[model samples]
Target: MNDAVRELYSENRYPDLSHPVTDISRLWVSARAGGLERLPEPAACRVLELGCAGGQNLLPLAARYPKSEFTGLDYSDTAIRKARQASYEAGLHNIRFEAADLEHWRPSHPCDFLIAHGVFSWVPDEVKTRVLDLCGQVLSDNGVACISYNTLPGWSLRSGLVPLVKALANNPAAAGLGDSVESVAASLADMAGGGTAHAANVQAICRDMVKKGPTVLPFDDFAPVCDAVYFAQFASWAGERGLRYLGEARLQDNLPDGISPHAFDRLAPLATDPILLQQTLDLLSGRTHRNSLFCRVDAMLEDGMTTGVVMNFAAGRGLVELPPVESRVVGLFRQLLEEIAPSCLAMQELVERTADRLGAGWEPSRHGRELTGWIYQAARLGGIELRSEPLEIRSHSMAAPRLSALNLHFAAAGRPVVDARHFPCRFPDGHERLLAAMNGSRAADELAEHARAEFPELDFHRWLAHLAERGIVE
Candidate 1:
């Protein structure tokens, strides 16, 4: 073990980050979308995370799913010390943490879900191989693994500059990163005479790195080793170890509809192989990183979505349309679905009702394919979700908007609130200021009256609907 590495982490703990894509529900759903029906339920499963600094990502899951088991492993003793304390203080009984070196730590039993977020690209080649090998060995028969990394062609430009960034980072004379980053950006500002995509790529990456600032720079740009590889190369490594790519943890990445069909169509014929197609897509799309999901090579994964396998998707509950959701065709469905908060309707009923709501804009016979594509894409984008089962929440719904005991508990404790789907969500801050009035007894207007002191400008009724839509309220 490198003492310097441990010391670096002891002083500079990486940010406490949580990703919806890393959540079991999202991973299970992504697997379901890929036609794997037999994976463990998100509500009751065993999850293990490698490189889990402070256990921020796994902590919330353990709290949200009491029956499930979670274990986080990290090499940093300080981080593990903090994670265990946090877990204990939160009264969480199902989660555990180990200060383990990934090179030597071994799981006593297989985990249903394995996560190695941001570990592959930063480690040495041998450690990277061991990560894939460990997944192939310790992953349960029905497990899914999410291994995220910096990808090549896209990340090539940024990674090539790492050495330079590190060299500049060594200068103690510079008091802050702003001036140092500016010097780097200024140096590259004239690349390709400042007008080409290559030049723009360099400048954009430099700015993004700077925006992350000092908190991220020490471990990232100035780390001893930060590497990136081609998507195909990474997949090949996993494949050699008996793990095969299933899909992406971020569902939207698996869908090609984000880009114009014409553009995608133009590139499809050039790359006949799917993996090559993905590489070409990344190159063209300027994607610098990927969160690829993998499963055992022999797993029963298919090409299309199937029934009997659960898929629970949901749309946001904002009163007005939200960005990352600009398709006019899906707007009506988003509006109609937002009202169905605290619950999810079956796809058929949902489609029929939403169609009726559309009236003249949608016709069944002409728009079947279009409608399917729209909602499915919307679901992928989280504008709407498709699920095989109704959400199991302890709170009552609709007539009297009440916060769930869990949500109320989280809010009262000054912890971040998680949506019904178990994603750590960004709710309007000072929500605790309004939670005391949401006990199912207060009328909407009365609640609005109380909210006026803190949120006079917010559309109270719509905000309530938004709360329900996000599954924050009962």
Candidate 2:
């Protein structure tokens, strides 16, 4: 099974790109949200990424944090070779990659942060055991580990399509999943019928896989081992290995969408077991996958509940996805957030602001819970972010905008450059004069001044802002 899997990957190498959720900042925030204290800082920490592929995820992190050390391990030599080459090209020195399976690849020192993004659910049972065991053995006292997996009930229908995908992978004439997925999905949609759960699942998966690119096909949808377990079952496995559930990496994933407050109130009491409660919510919402955080059981027991990390986070984003409500307080809070668009405020500052704005009737000691509750709910609903550090986006575009030369080269060649967000995106056609003008030298400002005539419709300042947003400039 291992040889076959290794051969499959060598034949089809996965494309490299950043997986932001696996970033230690995200794991730190999740752990902090769950009441952990004194975890390592993201700026300078020991990090490990299992199944790191071509190092797209870890390499960016290494570049971002020059003070940090990183190690990437994968079973495939092909993936590790490419990762090493990429790190060298990126001029990164703080990272290393090795071709070794989780079962036998033990590091001398434990990592402050460990990531197994797409590995846990796609390997054999013994390998899965090793993953948990290694995590428990090598994770630091207060360190957090991230693992993602397919969920049950929601995956029940999708698992049926896995065989078909695997068959396509074995086919000789079939070139790749790009075209193959379209045809298979089309036939499956017809068989599943319109408006059926099976049809919806097929459509959603196909769309997402295509958007994520070819790297997803063999590894995610048609791996040799594709297992799905309930949240409670996974928690039990972690507990047996001396690890405990911290929280969901994507906090909003914790919420059972489409449930009314009244209905949830009645159901919440019956499901008091936190693990069982999350599993029930998964079943209720038909959740397909989960990004879970775990820590040593002793670490969790030692440090009890505290909201210091969460409360100090610089919160931003708006209250766009608030829960169903008609409270005047909620309305006032939402309005305040809207007025401060594109700017993050300290949690305490937000709390104090809310207290002051609501007249003398709103006491910070008592009614602050109202503001905090709304903040938590809004965050869970994917409306806002609670981060230890604020993003360094420019408020205004630069007059003489400086862009990465490599990025401009890609733009001119019609290739997508990894953006500031670390996602791949390309500039559309018809920006020839503009791209040519941005030679990364001061000549950009002068040449752009003339090209501004040739391209009168172009808003130079706004265009630079767009580039800045992509991390290509500024």
Candidate 3:
């Protein structure tokens, strides 16, 4: 069964660039914010990713942190071959992709981080068990493991589409499955004629699934082996395997959203318990998917949540401080943005600077809770990010911008997510020319001359400032 699964993926090839949130650094930031401590530093950590397709996720990590070691396991020979080729092209020497299966493979050494994204619910029961068991075997004492899977209740609505899809298109692995899914979906919609509610619902789902392309339809929604569990059942399953829930990779999900003002009033009793709280929130949000982080059951808990790490995403992408709605904290948010707008800062530093800008005797400890809450809001908005390491902003004095080899290669290849310092960047307009100019051989004046000729309207200094702020160049 597992071999067949591999064959399908290898032949079909799921070759798109994976999302950056699956990066261990993102998990590290979320875990620290969620009150887990003593995490292995990203620079020095060893990482293992099960079902890592084409090394899209780990190659950036290897490129960013030269000291870290990354090993990706995938049963698809085609995927592994492409991953190896990519690493070779990027000149990344710290990563390896091996063609191996979860149920049969053994770990050579313990890893500080283990990632299993998009693999849990898609594989067979035995393979899923082996994945969890492998995490237990390979994870270090203080290691953090991140696993993403489809969840119940939220997925309950979507699950109905599976049987309907299969009934129409019996063989999910057929060559034109994508086209078949689209055709059957149209036929179903025509049959419904906007009368039967269930038929209408199924047709709507099929129409939505068609956008994902035929290649993705089988494994994503109509796969033969996909399974989902409620949050509680998943927690119990992990506990039985010697792992405990830490938090979701997205911190906001782990915390209450205050949408229902009395939610905490009603669920406060279960708030102290991680699993119960997660399950309750799952019900509230109708969450269909989860990116969960866990650690060894005996791993030490922190005294309090960390304020040490800085956020990763660049500011102004989706983070903005609105005046009319959140008026109360708008002033503080505005002040912070003005002070640290294209530069990254630690929470404590941001607070102190806010205090200094405000007036005399303003202490960070005095406004600790309020400041932390605002920072959390800013983080949620994507306006501010928290990271353990501060970025080194490039200045005009520097001879040339120091871009990573991976970023250079990605820019040339037009890959969407490029490695920027230790972070992944998915800028809208793209940064090809800017990256191309950062060959380390060009001096500041020479680069400026080149930029002026290429881009007449662009503010060369502003471009450099933006690149520096994004940690794309140092």
Reference-based lDDT, residue 79, model 1: 84
Per-model RMSD to reference:
5.9, 4.5, 5.6
- lDDT digits (tens) for residues 1-474 of candidate 3: 466666567577674456556666567777776556678878799999988887777888788678999999998888898789889988989999999977889998999889898889998888888988987888898888899898887688778766766566666554354347677666565665656755665656667676665766666776666788898998888998899888877655565343474775688788678687888888786677888998898887775544443332222212444433343333564566565555555545555556776666455554555556556665654545555554444433345776767666666665544544334455445346666658688877777787678766667767677676666765
Q: Give lDDT tens digits, candidate 2, residues 71-130.
A: 999877888987787677557799999999677777889888989888888887888899
Q: Best candidate, TM-score-wise?
A: 2
Report every candidate's CA lDDT.
0.71, 0.71, 0.70
Q: Residue 244 of model 1: what lDDT? A: 80
Query: Which 10-residue window in model 2 sums to the lowest lDDT?
Result: 301-310
Candidate 1: global Cα-lDDT?
Answer: 0.71
